[model samples]
Target chain A: MEELLAEVVNVLVVIVEACGAAVIIIGAVWAFARFAWVGFRQRTTAAFVPVRLTLGRFLALGLEFQLASDVLRTAVAPSWEELGQLAAVAAIRTALNYFLSKEIAEERRQVAAEQDHHEVTSTDHRGSGV
Target chain B: MSAVAEVTRLAALGTGLAAVVAGALALVVTRRPLPALAVLLDLLLAAGLLRLAGDPDWQGIVTAAAIVALRHLIGVGLRAGGRAWTGPRPPAASAQEKSAL
Candidate 1:
């Protein structure tokens, strides 16, 4: 029975890891496709705002999946080596996620500021009737 | 082979395949040089997972770290490029002379 339980747990771990990889793949593909379409349609410099925002979000999601998979890999009886590796992987992934999120927030603020500037300029132009 | 080990191998293979596909898609999507960095990260993560599955792939982790560093370097270069591209260009000497006249 214990052997059977181990097998079950191993299977679960594999499934979780597979799911995490799938999530990262899907997120990256989706963000890339969206960015491509936007870039093709609008060749303006402003097009980068949406591209950056979308890519940033996808990257954060992918990093989360990678982190989850790392955690799951150690769910079973982890050796000291495995534990050490997990610690390193987890730290790297967490740091990447943190910085990506911070950049995303900064990009969001820039986008908002640009929109506000555009609105004010339009309002001023309209008020002057030119 | 033990069932656990077999499952881990399969999982690693699946992850590698997914990462390759994701990387290809990212590369295809953008003309800018930015997406390549993300693609490299995806590939690195996939390689790292495979290494974790008892594969003798110590170099994968090192390569991933190098790729991350390269991504940072590229990001800095891109930022500089963007600033140069957008910054005001000085008026041509002819235009300046005409204005002066």
Candidate 2:
């Protein structure tokens, strides 16, 4: 029974890790395409902001999957060495994930502020013109 | 090494290459080095994270850590430099002044 359980876990770990890799690949390809299109069409520094935000979102998602796999690895039986390695990897990933999410929030706030400013300025212009 | 690890490494390499291309394109089109640099750093971080998908050894862990550190350093530097590029004339202005020059 123990061997059977370990086998199932090993298979699950592989599947989860593959899913995480796939997410990263898809995200990278999508972001690259958007980057090229936006850079070509808009050609402004501000325009690339959305693309960066999207990429960050994808990366954060992928990291979550990877972190899950890390946890699953230690579920069956974790030696001291394995646990130590897991701790290191998990810490690094957690830190990256936190920073990415924070940056995304900040970027969203900035974009919103800019849009609000634009709307107010346009309103003021129209009001003064009359 | 397992097949999954091999595939993940290859994917990471491809992602890194895509990052370089995207970064160069942004640099060329936007004509702003700072934004381009930020894009490059961000994509490289993605690549680094992707590399950690499989069973990463100590070396792989260290490499990813280094990338995270570098990204943080560069990100702080860019933020300090200001949110936007400060020095150069806007591209539109440069284009208009091209005839005068």
Candidate 3:
């Protein structure tokens, strides 16, 4: 009876593990799709197109890698190596977030500079008007 | 049932209630859903981790912590992510801003 109960528990664990792996895959894919859509939307603005696209691509890659690590964790991990990989994946996500925000800040700064220059030029032209 | 079990159940119930109240208050107080959801997610993460840590495997603990981090990230991310809150803000003139006065 004890052996049978142990087998049942193991089976249940495996099932849950599979479910967890599937969840990570779905979540990562969803995140990547959202990132791509956001990138496409930003492209319409024609501002910071290159920086934004690069950042979005990096974020999507990070999400995919993180998802892969998450799936591997549930599949074969009850080990230090797998846990370390998961940790690294988490770190990469954090780094990706950091760079994306940096990109946004740079974009904002560029916009502000352009606006200021426009204002200055317009003011100078108006002042020089005969 | 058993006293410990009863108390645990009650604590769980209380946490649930607090979570709901916080969520409602968040909308009224901040008028935003994402931050409120993040707060609720964090609370749930804490409650689950506290309850499940004893029997947890390695993968479970890391996954749980990562989930909590994501919730926290959502809060900061949305703050920096710039939601579609752009609109005609209050004009510079206080006289213009004063609608009731």
Candidate 4:
């Protein structure tokens, strides 16, 4: 039984190493695409990031629900540290997304307010000219 | 193939499929892709961490660090890209001015 355990362990080690290497390569490709593409980032943020944050704010309870599910899943059969890492990733992504969305909203509100101010001043100037 | 080997192969398949899908979707769906592109990176990182969890090694930790760095880079790109995309559209007169110049 010990021998069998060691064999599986060794295989898992190789598998993990393989996966890690692949992720590194994937990161590189992502970096490359972001740089190589023209104007790809512009369209994505307008449509998605805010949408993500708005959903995230509403999904707070759902997150707790997910945590409960994760705890149960891990408790039943301890899969690996990967699940923990994935959870970490999810948390970081969501938190960062929340902050970013807040910033974007702030900027939009400012711009809109300015536009309204500009319109009011322009109309006032026209009345004086007439 | 042994179960361990099969698992590894499956992980490989998953990573490849995710990269392709994410990249393609990013190209099709948005003008600003920095954030969505990060999803692809996350998927790859998840695969690595998942495998490492089973394997438990130093290399896995290193991989995680690299992935984080990439995520940061994407955040930076998104900031820059958002500014450019959202820059106020020049009034039509400016377009005519440029055409004259």
Using DockQ as the measure, which candidate wins?
Answer: 2
Please tell me which model should have the higher lDDT, number 1 or number 2.
2
Best by TM-score: 2
Better of 2 and 3 by TM-score: 2
Query: How should the candidates be ordered by lDDT, best one leading?
Result: 2, 1, 4, 3
Query: What residue pairs are clashing in model 2?
Result: none
Using DockQ as the measure, what is the rank order of every candidate, best first?
2, 1, 4, 3
Best by lDDT: 2
Candidate 1 lDDT score at position A84: 66
True contacts kept of 2: 0.79
TM-score versus the correct structure, for each prediction: 0.64, 0.88, 0.30, 0.37
Winner by TM-score between candidate 4 and candidate 1: 1
List model 4 lDDT by residue over B10-98, tens digit each: 66456556655655666566544565565455445344433333333445546645654575577567667777886777789689989
Report the alpha-carbon TM-score of model 3 versus the true structure. 0.30
Q: What are the iRMS values of all candidates?
A: 5.8, 1.0, 15.3, 9.2
- Candidate 4 residue pairs that clash: A40-B31, A40-B32, A40-B33, A41-B32, A41-B33, A42-B32, A43-B31, A43-B32, A44-B32
Off by over 4 Å in 4: A1-47, A50-130, B1-16, B31-39, B45-55, B88-101
Better of 2 and 3 by DockQ: 2
lDDT of 4 by residue, A1-130 (tens): 8566656655544454444444433443443344234224544333433333333232233233333333333333335565665455445435534544565476467457767989999999999999
Once superposed on the true structure, which residue ranges of model 2 sit more than 4 Å away at CA? B83-101
State in Å the error of residue A67, model 3: 8.3
